[model samples]
Target chain A: MTTTALKARKEFGKTLASDIAHRLRNEIVTCQLKPNESLKFDALRLSFGASFTTLREALTLLAAEGLVVAEEQRGYKVAPVTLEDLHDLTHARILIEVDLMRRSIEKGDDDWEIRVISSLHRLARIEERAPEDYASNTEWKAAHRQFHEALVSASGSPTLLAVRNSLFDRAERYRNLSAMFRPHPRDKAGEHRALMQAAIGRNADQACNLIASHIQTTSNNVAKYASGVISAG
Target chain B: MTTTALKARKEFGKTLASDIAHRLRNEIVTCQLKPNESLKFDALRLSFGASFTTLREALTLLAAEGLVVAEEQRGYKVAPVTLEDLHDLTHARILIEVDLMRRSIEKGDDDWEIRVISSLHRLARIEERAPEDYASNTEWKAAHRQFHEALVSASGSPTLLAVRNSLFDRAERYRNLSAMFRPHPRDKAGEHRALMQAAIGRNADQACNLIASHIQTTSNNVAKYASGVISAG
Candidate 1:
């Protein structure tokens, strides 16, 4: 009943759940598991090699994050991606990311602006290549994500950024789907540069418009491939 | 491989994990578990009286949904809500919901409009008073959610709708937080009426703006109280 005891009890409870959730999350987000893939318990148990208690602890955390789909009679499967999902996701992505960018443009200081510019520079230098057969190519993906993340990092709202990050992750699966098919567009670099320039110049309105269009551009491209896959099946 | 053999392999591979994920998702989203609460596995296992495999399946599914947060060292805990999170979440909510409303309006026919009107009416009739001494009132919450969901149900984009639902669940936690503070503004009824009218009238631009403002109005109110709490602490 004491205050200290109550605090300890609460902390202990939180610690366990969060730990399990973290491991499961990294596995899914990292694509250690494939999309729409079934997650078998015995397999998962052996994979983690942890006790049932600890593994359950982790899974409950993952369930809350929406990486897996829960079926009625069926068990969890990795969440699937479709072109329709991608389009809407991109729409929401542009809305949130562009909004964040605009906010960052308004609230961001010179240092924040510099950070955005630097992240862009890193992205510009990294060459985009196939994720497979071209092992070094993942650096490009990582850099590209960092650049986009940097633009909104100074938006001054953790919740917005967190949601933004989740949307980005969901989009990533779709992005991967399209990765092997199309050649990297030439204009992407130019598009990003314009976006950075607008933000740094504090043209919040134009920046928002550009970001929205930029987000839509990718969605339109991804939709074609996703639709084909969905339609074929 | 024979067709039957392949089919059997697929069937056998799918089990336990996703099944548990589905059940756990329902428990969390239906508010079976309180927000910011810890999910104790031992207790959950006993409650369901199922094996460890069954529980882990459910928890993993929830994690994918972003309803739970995974901590590195800690176990699974329900995602917490703060005033900052509410502010960001509400803004994102308005952005998505308003856009969905516009799409729904554009795609909706007479029946779609009727559904919205009916859902709002049902919500208006629901008793807002707590249902019992211990349990939160489910009827009002269900009605409230249905009204908003109905507005976007005809948006014709499953992906957008799914993301919208996820954000709504997170927002519910904040709503719960605000509920404990004091009486919310009483004019929510009027605002919903206006929103429904604008959508039915097919005033896409007006409906969009109205919804944006409508969502902001509530967010601002809730946030004001939440901020006060933070500052006091």
Candidate 2:
């Protein structure tokens, strides 16, 4: 094979795998593929317009991010979203993220605070409604994700942020799915404002405590909502 | 495929994937693949004597646990080991683990204390050599991992335990790779004994501090050793 041909083929494979990866990540994160739904290679090949190898490569990336589960023979599935998982995920999130916020408050500069404030502004403006159901709006989902990511981006520890992001991604599916069954009335905007106020003021203890309570409140709310459905079913 | 034929095929796939998963996991944890080694698919398939489907499935499982990284076109690679990563991983471990030890002290049963003591006794029995050349000793590695796991198994949080196990698996490769560097005089067994004593005596603060220092000391030693080689390279 010519060098040019080999290089072209490599580029093609790279683009194909990444394209497939982006589509699969969005599908799992947004629940286009329902929880515990099996992913078949043959069907995915036709749908994704890729070969078995390309599709598996994409799935491997998703699996690394905890957005998908791969079973030996059963094939890949959207990772099961459970109340217990939500509770644990949130607890771990608080454990890592609150510390991150504390560190960020200690080390974050004006630019970091600016980023946090901007993300909060965006979140406050977003409409929070059911993501599905035609007339429903949940631009809040995207805004909420941005706000949380911004909170830790200043943590300055790449591994901490990376693990935090993974936990957040996994928690998102459960959060959206259970949102329809349960609506939170408490002022999320207020919580964000207080969190920002504390962090901007460089009050690490208050910021840490607020973040912990904020996470705990969401965990309790989601767990109650999800368990209610299981019993009802 | 016919129904019976389909069922048989699935069984075969399941066994093959699972077997590869088990072997691959051990190979990784034991540092057989080495840190940052390229995992070309064809080579892995040949090494494992498995089909592409089976190998992909196994790699997916490892990827989920953060033991390996998947590249878009290049294929999988053993996750890299670095001092920065070790520092972050160690800090995260200490945070979760110290909290866990405290919880175990507060909530642990007599059996829990006994198990901790037993693990300490076993760990104390193992000879501490220069890990530089001892990285390949299978028996020593197994005993070391078991000792650490047994300490926190009484924490009563499966999620926490699972995350801890995952971090430890990733750190082992760095530990092995860094082992080939200079030796530092560290109290290899005394630290474990002190931690165990404090825990059994219900000295939460002492136990927590000991564990934290214990982990950081090793991190510092490994960092000192790796920096020279890493910079030279």
Candidate 3:
């Protein structure tokens, strides 16, 4: 084979591995694949229809993101969820995300305001359209992520935004896994509306407090609802 | 071959890839491998005595840490050092690292105080013994890292610490590559001593301010010294 062809083939292999990883990442983050579930080579090979090398590469990527746990010679498993982890993640997010939101409120221009409102509108639509399965609804998840991202879109720091993103994704898993049905769904629309109102009004203090409360409320629900699945300790 | 032997061989392959990556990281971070320099696979294979696959894996790991940049179909280059990057990294580090330091000052216990003193002592020793070559001195590098790490060791949040560590390493590159000769050397030992004093005094405000100033001072030195190598824009 020509050198160019060999390089192309190698690139193709990498892209394929990454593609498989993306699919697995989506499944794992949304709880389509349960936490602590064994990801045996045989079973995953059947499911992903990729070679062991490709599958292993994909798993390694997920492991780096803390979604999958690599067991030296044994293989991989979905990382287990526990309330303790949720509390720590929630606490960190509050510190970083609230600071980001405050900066966004202080510095956000008209374009930033527009994005906040647009994302909020989209999120509200998904909540109304897919209220029943909103927890596991992929569309809702994306819209929800967009709304929060837009809130901090003008944080003016890529580094802080990256940190916020990682914490958000880790928190997403716990939210999806727990509380399939909330006796009271915690007035998410009202909370989001208040958040938007405070942000656009340039009330940094209110926005920060509202976000801190919003994050903790969800965390509380996850703790109570996921008691069966996650240990409190 | 037995199944066990095959598994062992696979593990060994991974270990070799990671070992090469660690060696490359130390060299790159210490500026032995200059910034924006090409990382041709052939040269790396000859130098590291590793196969193409192992070297590629090693490069990929460094790429993830922003130590290496991958150019499609052209292989890789060490990530560039720029004044703009230094400014942004410095700003972000000030926000996160200062907050972490404040938390440590507020919450750090007796043991944390001991670590603070010990790390400061080590850092001072390196600055005195290796003053001439401290910038590229690997021992000084490790000592410097430990001192900063110890400052935020009681931040009570792993997430924030991880963010601080990444920003620290990225900034380390700029400082090493750009300021091999600081006209004033910035009195690093004095600054570190002040940070330790404020921290141990349980004075969060002073400690946070001191850290912020300490970071900006180094950035100022890098900016002026590296004017020749980096475009100001």
Candidate whose lDDT is highest? 3
Error of 3 at A136 (Å): 2.7
lDDT of 3 by residue, A86-140 (tens): 8778888898888899889989999999999999999998888877757566787
Query: How does chain B score by TM in each prediction?
Result: 0.77, 0.83, 0.86
Rank order (by lDDT, best first)? 3, 2, 1
The TM-score obtained by chain A of candidate 2 when compared with the true chain A = 0.83
Per model, state how many residue pairs clash: 48, 0, 0
Worst-scoring 10-residue span by lDDT in model 2 chain B: B5-14
State the DockQ, from 0 to 1, for candidate 3.
0.30
Candidate 3 stretches greater than 4 Å from native: A1-14, A71-74, B1-14, B71-75
What TM-score does the first chain of candidate 1 have? 0.78
Per-residue C-alpha lDDT of model 2 across residues A112-170, encoded as one tens digit per residue: 98889998887765633332332124467677778877777787776667778878877
Local lDDT at B205 for model 1: 92
TM-score result, candidate 3: 0.86
- Give the candidate number with the greatest TM-score: 3
| Per-candidate iRMSD | 5.5, 3.4, 3.3
Return the number of clashes found in candidate 2. 0
